[model samples]
Target: MSSDMNKDWPLYEVFIRSKNGLDHKHVGSLHAADATMAIENARDVYTRRMEGNSIWVVESKYITASDPSAQDPFFDPAEDKIYRHPTFYELPEELTHM
Candidate 1:
Protein backbone atom coordinates (compact mmCIF):
# COMPACT_ATOMS: atom_id res chain seq x y z
CA MET A 1 0.00 0.00 0.00
CA SER A 2 0.96 3.60 -0.51
CA SER A 3 2.49 5.56 2.37
CA ASP A 4 -0.56 7.84 2.63
CA MET A 5 -2.94 4.92 2.94
CA ASN A 6 -0.69 3.23 5.47
CA LYS A 7 -0.65 6.41 7.55
CA ASP A 8 -4.41 6.35 7.75
CA TRP A 9 -4.35 2.97 9.45
CA PRO A 10 -4.08 2.77 13.22
CA LEU A 11 -0.77 1.86 14.79
CA TYR A 12 -0.60 -1.42 16.69
CA GLU A 13 1.87 -2.65 19.30
CA VAL A 14 2.75 -6.31 18.98
CA PHE A 15 3.71 -8.61 21.83
CA ILE A 16 4.76 -12.22 21.52
CA ARG A 17 5.24 -14.96 24.08
CA SER A 18 7.86 -17.56 23.24
CA LYS A 19 7.33 -21.26 23.96
CA ASN A 20 9.36 -21.11 27.18
CA GLY A 21 8.56 -17.53 28.23
CA LEU A 22 5.96 -16.89 30.92
CA ASP A 23 5.25 -13.31 29.84
CA HIS A 24 4.63 -11.65 26.51
CA LYS A 25 7.25 -9.14 25.37
CA HIS A 26 6.82 -6.22 22.96
CA VAL A 27 8.45 -7.06 19.64
CA GLY A 28 7.55 -4.13 17.42
CA SER A 29 4.83 -1.93 15.93
CA LEU A 30 2.84 -1.94 12.71
CA HIS A 31 -0.06 -0.18 11.04
CA ALA A 32 -3.25 -2.15 10.48
CA ALA A 33 -6.93 -1.57 9.79
CA ASP A 34 -7.96 -3.40 13.00
CA ALA A 35 -6.89 -5.81 15.71
CA THR A 36 -7.35 -8.92 13.54
CA MET A 37 -5.24 -7.57 10.74
CA ALA A 38 -2.64 -6.49 13.26
CA ILE A 39 -2.30 -10.02 14.58
CA GLU A 40 -1.92 -11.51 11.11
CA ASN A 41 0.64 -8.89 10.15
CA ALA A 42 2.53 -9.32 13.40
CA ARG A 43 2.69 -13.09 12.95
CA ASP A 44 3.93 -12.80 9.37
CA VAL A 45 6.46 -10.09 10.16
CA TYR A 46 7.71 -10.89 13.68
CA THR A 47 7.29 -14.63 14.00
CA ARG A 48 8.01 -16.03 10.53
CA ARG A 49 10.46 -18.40 12.24
CA MET A 50 7.62 -19.77 14.42
CA GLU A 51 9.45 -18.83 17.59
CA GLY A 52 6.47 -17.48 19.45
CA ASN A 53 3.56 -19.56 20.77
CA SER A 54 1.24 -16.67 21.66
CA ILE A 55 0.62 -13.21 20.20
CA TRP A 56 -1.07 -10.10 21.50
CA VAL A 57 -1.99 -7.08 19.40
CA VAL A 58 -3.11 -3.78 20.88
CA GLU A 59 -3.83 -0.45 19.24
CA SER A 60 -1.13 2.02 20.28
CA LYS A 61 -3.55 4.80 21.18
CA TYR A 62 -5.31 2.72 23.86
CA ILE A 63 -2.15 2.16 25.88
CA THR A 64 -1.38 4.51 28.75
CA ALA A 65 2.06 4.79 30.27
CA SER A 66 3.82 6.74 32.94
CA ASP A 67 5.94 9.65 31.84
CA PRO A 68 9.65 8.89 31.73
CA SER A 69 10.51 12.31 33.16
CA ALA A 70 8.46 11.56 36.28
CA GLN A 71 9.91 8.12 36.86
CA ASP A 72 11.36 8.85 40.33
CA PRO A 73 8.21 10.39 41.79
CA PHE A 74 5.91 7.97 40.03
CA PHE A 75 7.66 4.89 41.42
CA ASP A 76 9.02 6.31 44.69
CA PRO A 77 5.99 5.30 46.73
CA ALA A 78 6.77 1.63 46.26
CA GLU A 79 10.22 2.02 47.84
CA ASP A 80 8.70 2.90 51.21
CA LYS A 81 6.61 -0.29 51.25
CA ILE A 82 9.25 -2.73 52.38
CA TYR A 83 6.85 -5.64 52.78
CA ARG A 84 6.33 -5.69 49.03
CA HIS A 85 9.94 -6.70 48.53
CA PRO A 86 10.66 -10.38 48.08
CA THR A 87 13.56 -10.29 50.58
CA PHE A 88 11.03 -9.74 53.39
CA TYR A 89 10.10 -13.42 53.32
CA GLU A 90 12.16 -16.56 52.95
CA LEU A 91 11.16 -19.03 50.29
CA PRO A 92 11.21 -22.75 50.84
CA GLU A 93 14.26 -24.65 49.52
CA GLU A 94 11.95 -26.53 47.18
CA LEU A 95 10.78 -23.30 45.55
CA THR A 96 13.18 -23.37 42.64
CA HIS A 97 11.77 -20.53 40.62
CA MET A 98 11.26 -18.13 43.50
Candidate 2:
Protein backbone atom coordinates (compact mmCIF):
# COMPACT_ATOMS: atom_id res chain seq x y z
CA MET A 1 0.00 0.00 0.00
CA SER A 2 2.39 2.69 1.25
CA SER A 3 6.17 3.04 0.91
CA ASP A 4 6.59 2.99 4.68
CA MET A 5 4.61 -0.24 4.99
CA ASN A 6 6.72 -1.92 2.34
CA LYS A 7 9.89 -0.70 4.03
CA ASP A 8 8.82 -2.41 7.26
CA TRP A 9 8.40 -5.79 5.52
CA PRO A 10 11.31 -8.17 5.38
CA LEU A 11 13.02 -8.98 2.12
CA TYR A 12 12.70 -12.58 0.94
CA GLU A 13 14.60 -14.57 -1.66
CA VAL A 14 12.52 -16.77 -3.92
CA PHE A 15 13.58 -20.10 -5.42
CA ILE A 16 11.61 -22.28 -7.76
CA ARG A 17 11.91 -25.93 -8.70
CA SER A 18 10.61 -26.73 -12.14
CA LYS A 19 8.50 -29.77 -12.93
CA ASN A 20 11.45 -31.49 -14.57
CA GLY A 21 14.17 -30.15 -12.30
CA LEU A 22 15.60 -31.76 -9.16
CA ASP A 23 17.03 -28.57 -7.67
CA HIS A 24 15.58 -25.18 -6.90
CA LYS A 25 17.02 -22.06 -8.49
CA HIS A 26 16.82 -18.51 -7.22
CA VAL A 27 14.29 -16.59 -9.28
CA GLY A 28 13.96 -13.21 -7.55
CA SER A 29 13.32 -11.30 -4.34
CA LEU A 30 10.30 -9.69 -2.70
CA HIS A 31 9.14 -7.98 0.47
CA ALA A 32 6.65 -9.79 2.75
CA ALA A 33 5.46 -9.76 6.33
CA ASP A 34 6.54 -13.37 6.93
CA ALA A 35 7.50 -16.68 5.32
CA THR A 36 3.95 -17.69 4.42
CA MET A 37 3.25 -14.43 2.66
CA ALA A 38 6.60 -14.62 0.88
CA ILE A 39 5.73 -18.05 -0.55
CA GLU A 40 2.32 -16.91 -1.84
CA ASN A 41 3.83 -13.81 -3.38
CA ALA A 42 6.60 -15.80 -4.99
CA ARG A 43 4.19 -18.32 -6.54
CA ASP A 44 1.94 -15.56 -7.91
CA VAL A 45 4.83 -13.48 -9.25
CA TYR A 46 7.12 -16.19 -10.61
CA THR A 47 4.99 -19.17 -11.57
CA ARG A 48 2.16 -17.49 -13.45
CA ARG A 49 2.76 -19.77 -16.47
CA MET A 50 2.91 -22.93 -14.34
CA GLU A 51 6.64 -23.12 -14.93
CA GLY A 52 7.55 -24.53 -11.52
CA ASN A 53 6.10 -27.20 -9.21
CA SER A 54 7.84 -26.26 -5.98
CA ILE A 55 8.69 -22.98 -4.26
CA TRP A 56 11.14 -21.96 -1.55
CA VAL A 57 11.26 -18.64 0.27
CA VAL A 58 13.96 -17.47 2.66
CA GLU A 59 14.44 -14.24 4.51
CA SER A 60 17.40 -12.20 3.29
CA LYS A 61 18.55 -11.39 6.80
CA TYR A 62 18.90 -15.08 7.81
CA ILE A 63 21.06 -16.17 4.93
CA THR A 64 24.82 -16.48 5.32
CA ALA A 65 27.04 -16.53 2.26
CA SER A 66 30.75 -16.62 1.66
CA ASP A 67 32.48 -13.47 0.49
CA PRO A 68 33.24 -13.54 -3.22
CA SER A 69 36.57 -11.77 -2.69
CA ALA A 70 37.80 -14.61 -0.45
CA GLN A 71 36.69 -17.40 -2.74
CA ASP A 72 40.09 -19.03 -3.20
CA PRO A 73 40.85 -19.60 0.49
CA PHE A 74 37.27 -20.42 1.39
CA PHE A 75 36.99 -23.28 -1.12
CA ASP A 76 40.59 -24.51 -0.97
CA PRO A 77 39.80 -27.08 1.74
CA ALA A 78 37.48 -28.98 -0.57
CA GLU A 79 40.22 -29.44 -3.17
CA ASP A 80 42.30 -31.56 -0.83
CA LYS A 81 39.46 -34.07 -0.40
CA ILE A 82 39.83 -35.92 -3.66
CA TYR A 83 37.82 -38.90 -2.44
CA ARG A 84 34.75 -36.73 -2.37
CA HIS A 85 34.83 -36.53 -6.16
CA PRO A 86 33.33 -39.19 -8.44
CA THR A 87 35.96 -38.93 -11.20
CA PHE A 88 37.72 -42.09 -10.04
CA TYR A 89 34.61 -44.20 -10.46
CA GLU A 90 33.46 -45.60 -13.77
CA LEU A 91 29.74 -45.79 -14.45
CA PRO A 92 28.05 -48.55 -16.34
CA GLU A 93 26.75 -47.80 -19.81
CA GLU A 94 23.18 -48.44 -18.63
CA LEU A 95 23.32 -45.52 -16.22
CA THR A 96 21.13 -42.92 -17.87
CA HIS A 97 21.70 -39.83 -15.76
CA MET A 98 25.36 -40.51 -14.95
Go through the candidates in order and give the C-alpha RMSD of each one to the true structure. 2.6, 3.0
Q: Which lDDT values do the candidates have, in the order given?
A: 0.91, 0.91
> Which residue runs of candidate 1 sit more than 4 Å off their true CA positions?
1-3, 76-88
Model 2 segments more than 4 A misplaced: 1-6, 76-84
- lDDT by residue (37-68, candidate 1, tens digit) is 99999989999998699999999999999899
Clashes of each: 0, 0
Model 1's lDDT to the true fold?
0.91
Question: How well is each residue in 1-98 modelled by candidate 2, as lDDT tens digits?
Answer: 78998789989999999976489999999999999999999988999998799999999988899899999998988988988988888888898876
